[model samples]
Target: MTKKIRLADVAAVAGVSTATVSRVLNAKSTVATGTKQLVLQALDELGYERPDALRDRSDDRVGIVAPDLNTPSAPEYIQELVDQLSLRDYAPILLTHSSAGGTEKYLQMLVKQNVSGVIFLSGVANESDYDVRRYLDEDERQIPYVTINGRNPNIGVPDFSSDDVGAVKDSVRHLYHSGHRSIGLITGPERFRPAQDMAMGYRQAMMEMCPDTDQTVLHSHYSVESGGRATDTMLDLGVTGIICGSDLLVLGAIRQIRQRGLRVPEDVSVVGYDDSPLMAFTDPPLTSNRQPVRQISSAAVNTLVDLMKGGNPPRVPFTFRSELITRESSGAAPNQSQF
Candidate 1:
């Protein structure tokens, strides 16, 4: 008969507390490295097969949660992540929730399914939201999880997000280098970390490069319609260049600029983020910031694997770099009289 391996038995053999053993078994992040190793070794010595859930590669199902799939960037990143996981012999199951359902409900649902792990992308809960902590401390406390484009201090889950600050700074600096003095920003809702970081980067860049230009930041949903309205507002305010948060927004802004009989780069210059699919083929190729989707997705998968192995992943936030891809939509700021 196989010997019964209780939590206390593992703790005694490992010379640690029962709680520490439980933490290791549950894949919690607080377990120290030394204690985790001892507990794992104890489990090995006890002649008990590891729990199926804790065993690596025994299961191939991983849950991927995203806020919405309508946008280009989220879907692109999800596909990349899925591909990477498949290469590692794990099958990815996707779950999408709207901004309205709340992250807590979706998270609880995933937990109930006993998924091997979870990866969240652009969900409603952000680094600043307290709801993340509530879910982190709830009924199920021991599942390995990773978040993309979101972070929280109290929650120990690993995060993989783009270097949004650097991206925005580069966008601003690019416009400045092209001689745009009065620049504007069309951004997503302020609550989201990506939007907030981009806005902060714009502000920091503005303060450093063109302190005299009036700061005109317009917050809107990450949609083309909002971009149109934002473009109109910025034009009315005499902005010579606009840095939009997404390529979709750039499309809308460009339409609005043309509707008003103004030519891109000739009337007002534009820079966009997330050089999504097909952006290079647009009427005039989009000049945008390219999110490091491949890097972020790989890091997220690797972190989840580490957690599953009872390893403490990096505590520091992981931010992947972005690059500015210049195209025809942007140019030197047109003469102020052009508007």
Candidate 2:
């Protein structure tokens, strides 16, 4: 007779609680990937057979392609996408693209894997420079897919993105009311649609509120170091408020502000986008624009799954607005700083 598999035994081997082992056994999508791997290894070591649900099923797999996983927002997007897919009885195969292997390689692999559908999360698909042809098959037939938070106009696929223009406009108006006339904008490269929208909003808002002031804007990579350099320039320009593209950039700006012996809000009020996880925990909790992450992820998964089921969703892109979360990082503008 085969020995009965015990959750407690597996938990002990995996160095986790039995509840965690149970969740893994039940194929719960909420478990972290690393924890799930450890549980599977524990089961193997304990001579237990794997659950049918945990077995490889390429037919049940949906591909999720995303940019740099190092970004703080990436994990949240991944987890939400995975959970939504799993709720519909689909498993997710995550492919994170890097400079060494662009998205083309992963898309080709997903094609060969026979994935049911694909969902893009803020990647080359959103950049105007990249051709949407990469998403097509050899005969030029498009694959069933959905994009979250950016779209290429060349491809008529279902897309869900935040209202980047409105977000920046709101941020600018907020700063203007706070007595900041000289506000600067820091965002990603112009090639990305979100950044372009933000730039447009910044120009529009600046024209409306501070007509005479120059439309101060700096484009930078979504990295801490790049954000710091951009902030240095804005500080030198004597801007009283700064709006950054991402929370990571805001962190860099905050650090740069301190290094200049200035206090956040007191010397240089800052606002961040993506109100990503842990923003509220920063030294001065970030004031940020909160993207509707869960709503967008759920919609993307549902739409893609529907497409896989032969249901036709409109090819038009859907845009969602963002909420400005006021926090400690933003305040009434201080007296003109000695630049």
lDDT of each: 0.81, 0.85
The digit string of per-residue lDDT tens for model 2 on 183-244 reads: 99999988888889999999999999999998888999999998899999999999989999
Highest TM-score model number? 1
- Error in Å for residue 31 of model 1: 14
Model 2 scores a TM of 0.80
Error of 1 at 172 (Å): 1.2
Task: List residue ranges in candidate 2 displaced over 4 A.
Answer: 1-57, 127-142
Deviation (Å) of 203 in candidate 1: 1.1
For all candidates, the clash counts are: 0, 0
For model 1, the run of ten residues with the poorest summed lDDT: 132-141
Candidate 1 residue lDDT tens string, 146-265: 888876555656788888899989999998999888889998898777888889999999999988878989999988899999999999988888999988789999999999889888
